[model samples]
Target: MTMQRRQFLGTMAAAGAVLGAPAVFGQAKPRVVVIGGGAGGATCARYIARDSEGAIDVILVEPSEVYYTCFFSNLYLGGFRDFESLGHRYDKLASDHGITLARDMAAGVDRDAGTVTLAGGEMLFYDRLVIAPGIDFADGSVPGWDLSKAEIMPHAYKAGPQTQLLKAQVEAMPEGGTFCMIAPPNPYRCPPGPYERISMVAHLLTQANPSAKILLVDPKEKYSKQGLFEEGWQRHYSGMITRIGPDFGGDKVEVRPEAMEVVIDGEVERVDVCNVIPGQRAGAIAEAAGVTDDTGWVPVNPHSMASRADPKVFVLGDASAQGDMPKSGFAANSQAKVAAMVIRAELSGSKAFPAKYSNTCWSLIATDDGVKVGASYEATDEKIASVDSFISQTGEDAALRKATYEESLGWYAGITADIFG
Candidate 1:
């Protein structure tokens, strides 16, 4: 942790003094078990621990030693961010907030008994549980694509070694060769992610392989901020990118990884590189805990993000089926804060505030060129509905786009601190 982050933590502690320390319950501090230390789980654990001021016992269950955020990962591909910048350790979350970091996978959850079983056979009893396991791809969502063949056609959506693999493949493409991407269906993690990835790849190829062509085989007829993306592509990378939506042979797609071929609408096309983003569902833990509905996502109370099946278990981030909120990291972090407040009120004596949430997703179309869409949300009895929204307009001046990109850098710094600290 840097001295700046340490100073921020000190200021946070000082603020806690003004709010009064949380009331402890019984002989032991109430325990909160958070699974998957990504955007949602980490933020929830940190807020509960920091705001409660030692009144709640927080345990973070994550398999990895460090977390790599899916957010800003496209910037890495565009050479605007380094791989290390995307990784965050749990040291500040544990040391500053007094959270117990358990680097272990949660294997099972016995909601009826209020206990979670770990992969190492240890059982943890919890007064409250938070499930924020992000996303897991559905099996066979893309025909003939599976985990075993990821090395040949890297999804690179998870922001780790796979991301590195995909970048390497793009850099190694033959001169004037074709690069193909099969975009995912609707309601996947990061609605604008696939398009941003296309932008980054195009930026790279402009200098490295200027004659290279990009093929976007997409299932959706239209995508998030389609006009803005189309305008940016035309302005910055004209004649190099082609998009085929569902009406134009994008829906009927099959991959042949062994032979490096993609069959679109009964026509086989060979490519030098392939990127397949399959359909997604909530992480496996949600289903294992029996919180998911027929839609493969956990249904929650929009106001508190409490699991509909069990109020004691809350689902956040991409795992949830909350309405009108895109599954971006910003949305997940916003939902975490709301859920943490509710959990703290139930476990400790912290006051619960009315649930208000917000998110903004920024994408880089080229160097110093960024576009964004965002909204504020309010929770109703039925769902978390959008209160107001905005998006980048096409034909915006370069100066404004550059400012937006710079603002994204600041947001990235602030949010990482918010989650890790």
Candidate 2:
């Protein structure tokens, strides 16, 4: 079923290039400039260019040439997958879909002028814009931890090199050493991410340094799939993982990267490695474009994923403040489809469909032991609200858990193809 979908989509992209390339108007085609080439932006760019044929000029402004997904990085940490497997390139979007891949950082957005300025001083004029730049760390949100000292305590939130560093640090921990993780607060990207990281780190430590301790200092009172995670932790890594919630001094935390120490509620604990994920907001380009609200995220129309601040722009993924949808890679890719459909309908006179979205987040607790949480969502008058939801149950049979893990592997293969192709 997944391969069929991929082949059909691939054919559509190929057909669009051949059948849709004639100039709609003499020389000037409607331009679409997409910023940030992650799940949302890459999918949006591919769909707009592929579906529109040659009616719209699609420009993807991304700083990095290769995008490493954060979704499966925890699996890499757990030794389920290699680091190289998480990386993806945009060569197909350019070669197959005829997208203009602008390998440069977007410096600013001139909404009134309909132009985006790159850091290299090139200006791209667009009739419509899509902003899917993902999240940025808030200034001074985590005391004593900032970008300058990232080497000492890597966040590993963005994937790529930081992920390698965090994995290396865990592998280098002394026997029975302590590994501390400072989890982020509410409304951040991937609610289940930190817990999954803890699980993966614990998986690694169990084999390499069985006596090592894992500490989770989290600001949130409760987390996504808490029951499932707690069960898995007890079943696979008993007495190895400890989570401190806000009521237990998780909120009041500070780090000293130089000394490799964490101060929690005025109590100091020295640790061998620290992974601190600070509070986050919409990416810098969204703020520069005046699309984000006061809460640091972009408010968008639920039906079209169009920015509420400006109808000419759309925001996707973690940067959007749409209600009820947890920010996951699946959600981002789902939202991108809705945005792409809307843009195609607006520009190319294509038929528009009602917006429906879904997401599933898979977390690996141990080798071949996986759990998942997922939901289906619909665009309501107010926001995108949950229609139905499901989660893996505690005490499920090992065979079922393994099957769920296998399902996620297929999904990862399908989604990466859907986004990149």
TM for every model, in the order presented, reads: 0.94, 0.94
Residue-wise C-alpha lDDT for candidate 1, range 1-421, written one tens digit per residue: 2223234335435654321132245446678989989999999999999999988878788878779999999888877789999999989987799887766789999998788877766567788899999999999899999999899999998989999999999999999999999999978999999999999999999989999999999999899989999999999999999999888899999999999999999999999999999999999999999999998999999999999999999999999999999999999999999999999898766789899999999999998889999999999998899999999999899999999999999999999999997
Per-candidate Cα RMSD to the true structure, in Å, reads 6.1, 6.1
Clashes of 1: 0
Q: Which stretches of candidate 2 lie over 4 Å from their true place?
A: 1-26
- TM-score of predicted model 1? 0.94
Off by over 4 Å in 1: 1-25
Residue-wise lDDT of candidate 2 within 158-201, one digit each (tens)?
Answer: 99999999999999999999999999988898999999899999
User: In candidate 1, what residue range of length 10 has the lowest lDDT sum?
Assistant: 15-24
